[model samples]
Target: MSLVNQQIQLVSRPMGEPTHDNFKLVEVPVPELQDGQVLVKHLWLSLDPYMRGRMNDGKSYAQPQPLDEVMIGGTAGEVVASKHPDYAPGDPVVGMGGWQLYSVVDGGQRGMMRKVDTTHVPLSHYLGAVGMPGVTAWVGLNHIIAPKAGETMVISAATGAVGSAFGALAKARGCRAVGIAGGPEKCAYAVNELGFDACIDYKAHPDLKSLSKALKDACPDGVDGYFENVGGMIMDAVMLRMNAFGRIAVCGMIAGYNGQPLPMANPALILVSRLKVQGFIVSEHMELWPAALKELGTLVGTGKLRPRESIAEGLAAAPEAFFGLLKGRNFGKQLVKLA
Candidate 1:
């Protein structure tokens, strides 16, 4: 084994869009494991929109990523060395190992490092569809949307990890799923491949008026529930189309994550439509993870949920890949293949 461990660190905070200078890749000596600790060699690293919030020093659901420390993220890997009795060498596990080639984790905490069964679902799925993103979709849908048959549900960032999984889950539950993606290709994939009833290309209709018209056209019955991912003009358009008593699960506001604060322009719509808007963090609801993951895993295992991924080749590509994700350049879940 190599003596050095390569990792990415946050060198600076981004003012708006993150630049290459914000990250620094460095190599460090691998630390020796202590009692009840295990060493893992990461195979995959997940780059998510939520990580952007962690970069800033402002208050958030999670703490900011300390400078010069490894960037925070989810990773899937095999235990290469073990001092913990429960974890043997070659055991497959997934956890929040951050942006590194190897991770040293305590077995007791392990970042919830449960063993994975790759015989059915691939190890990578444990990082995407069957992982946090997938469970997030489940939580929002089951707990928030609670859709009935024939209900029209719309989601923004429809080609992303959370949106794609949410769309599939809604479809399986007999609801009509409409998606809003950045490009035509992504929109097409959402409808044709992921089984979304319809998808609107936000890029094609740049203005709020045009996007609202497109959404109205796509969901003629009016939006019964909304899975919000980007809270900008897209959200304003959705707000205009929401039916009375509509429920919205405010999962993310990536449009304003960098520095812009795009507050809702249509607060009156919430009152006029009598909508119920709730924002939640998936990690806060660990009690529902077992049931949610079981359902998400079953869907993924049987091919019912077709989760797509846009994978970068190595850890060096992680920062660039994440930048692309912020600009809606990626087609699906953004991931880094470290191994």
Candidate 2:
């Protein structure tokens, strides 16, 4: 049977915030499978903040998402056709399959595709809780912050993919997990659903002074550790509440992902608090993935780690979903359901 693949390609690099005009949908005929190849029908596509940085034409942690190409993304899917001995039709897998309906995967390709066990952990989880976002939270908290029992840890963008996992993991480890989110609903969900100790609605507290006051109230003992997903003012507030010898993991700067340049409020806080702040890309730390994935997978499978998602219905909704993600419109993990 002949298969046609539908894909969304990066047609233009966005100046600041991305829009529908930056992408183009294209259809192509799937080629015949080679001896060591398989065709996967993508079921879910992960839309994340990191892709925003990839959309820009500049130097950063990774290479820019090239123009006129399939936009970078993670996908979970089922093998529809296989010529390789190891994979059979209907095998569930997850990989960096980009924004497409089907992905051509090579058996010889080591990291791009991996068969995932969905009996305990759902296949969609390979893109979120049991996937990169989960690993990111684990590495940042375990390696960088290293929060101990009874310590207070703050997370910004607290209801999104990385922060939600971070909050739940922190709580699991016996730390006081406090969150900073955009709206009251997200704030309530962070505390009520994610079990965060407290959640501050940044929208209600718009200015630096107001947010700092809220943070001080939330972290009465001061912030012993911080999982930074949003930078700018939220970060500034957290810094002010940092305890002596505090630790910080700079996971992302979502607040400044757009073209805006947000300067740090207090550069001297690092020295004053004797803070340890480290920035990392989870992909670089491949050694820790096995351990992290094991723990995260178990937590997700057992219902200990409850991660939420904002799923878009089709491949065409990718751009709009991603746009909302950048603006903190997404409730948890933003995903596109391709099938």
Candidate 3:
């Protein structure tokens, strides 16, 4: 007899926006481990904005998650059984285990799985602040933007996993962090909880002119750096506020995922503005994660980076939770608690 595992699979590619009908929940028997494999029982599943791009069968940085397969996702769980020498039962590890209750990893594959320390930081934080999202912030701020002290840095989706981490990381470098979120509550959290200098509610400003003015008021000295997550009008608005020679790290342009992408506005002329813009995929730069993870873990352990989480109760709730994530319905890191 084998373990029966519950998992979510993407049944169809989304046309405009994804719906519940696009996903299928099914149970399958966990496969027997090969000589070099280990079995992991997932405890948490991470749902991110990037997953949206993976759902479409289009040209992108990474391949489509693959139809009829387990919906791809990051997971933090314990190795329940192991045939590999490096991993033993009870080892806490993190990997791309998809949306499943169990995962079998070929321990021979490097970077496929990593054993993490949950003594200081909770295992769940590894999915958000202390994990990929945290590293994204570090890479963008340190590697690309590299803002100087007293400079102002603005980020869209400011209360999200990446945005929240970006604020604390920028502040550590003595940069004034400003965030633009959808509503007043999110703005308040960005300022008060995330330690951002100020936050602008994009919802309050319906048009591009209003959003730009709000950014102008929030960042009086002009924006020295921008960590772009939500693009489109947000990018246009932020572009108008960018100072000459400012740096922009385009991590996600989710504003264009479901439909036709938004065209850049006139203010985004890098030649005249002399702005340095770079779009990056963090997975491609694995060499930086060691240093980035160290700093993020310290921030959380020291109570400096208090990452908030919104956890859906079970595996079945992942799809709905993910939809909420794309719609800006979840605050902080969106996750599904599996076990």
Candidate 4:
């Protein structure tokens, strides 16, 4: 079997917003599988906001994506060849296949690669709702923001992969899930399609006072929990409306990801409201994945969690698609289809 692997590598680090110059796409021969390795032909590559953080060389929870190496990403694909006893060719699998059309993974690694059943759920959902993003939403909501029924839970980036999944999980726990998205279209989808109680178009309310008023109107009982995605003004607005003993799960700060300053407008509110704000990296909680995946997969299989995808056609489109995701240009989960 002869196969050439197409891959994208990070050639440079971005000072501000990433430019195309930072990435270089090239081709290489797919390495022959050894004793315990498996060859995976990536079908769907996930583009997420966390990847932006990995692009920077600065120290973080996870190691920075090395220069000249495959750009880091999650991929859902099918095994093309396997020397591992646990895997076989044609098995649907999920792993960190990176920005490439193919991957050679060591099946012996504890959590590096695993086979998946795509009968009830689509293979792509494993990269979004039933994969990392959905689990992120679950971990933050359950472990951090632990909301009670009848409490108001708000999430920014409402129509995004994590927020959409969070909306479903929050609703399942009987909390009033409110959403904050960038446009009228996203807001409409968040409310009508994703089943949020109300969704505020943050674009319409661009400033603190305006956004705070909108949040107040949508959440009449005050915000008992917040799943933060975008930071700065939206967070400031939420801070003003947070109830005593409120919880905040700080997920992504996309607003400041491009080197923008993201100072909270009111630090005193934290003390006054006595809010429990926690920032988490979901990878650290590997033990909870089975439970999270079980709930998320069930949600998708049962048609309760309807995840939308804005798919880019091929491996080359990943860069542009990721840029669109950072700019709020894509709807729902952003994925790249290699085949």
Q: Estimate each model's TM-score.
A: 0.97, 0.98, 0.98, 0.99
TM-score (C-alpha, index-matched) for candidate 1:
0.97
lDDT against the true structure, per candidate, is 0.92, 0.91, 0.93, 0.94
Winning model by TM-score: 4
Residue 170 of model 4, lDDT score: 97
Off by over 4 Å in 4: none
Q: Give me the displacement of residue 118 in model 2, in angstroms.
A: 1.4
| lDDT for 282 (candidate 3) | 99
lDDT tens digits by residue: candidate 4, 63-114: 9989999999999999989999999999999999999999999999988888
Candidate 1, residues 1-339: lDDT per residue as tens digits? 656899999999999889999999999999999999989999999999998999999989888999999999999999999999999999999999999999889999834588888989999989999999999999999899899999999999998889889988998889999999988899889988899999999899989899899998999999999999999899999999999999999999999988997977879998999999999999999999899889888988898888899999999999999999998888788899998
Tens-place lDDT digits, model 2, residues 1-339: 698899999999898788899999999888899899989999999998999999888889899999998999999999999999889999999999999999898977888898999989888888998899989999999999998999999988888888878987898899999998989999998998888999999999989999999998898999999998888988998999999999999989988898799899898999999999999899999999999888888888878778888999999999999998988889988899998
* Pairs with steric clashes in candidate 2: none
lDDT of 2 at 136: 96
Q: Roughly what TM-score does model 2 have, to 2 decimal places?
A: 0.98
The residue ranges of model 3 lying beyond 4 angstroms of the native Cα positions read: none
Candidate 3, residues 62-106: lDDT per residue as tens digits?
Answer: 998889999999999999999999999999999999999999999
In each prediction, how many residue pairs overlap at the backbone (N, C-alpha, C within less than 3 A)? 0, 0, 0, 0
Weakest ten-residue segment in model 3 by summed lDDT: 260-269
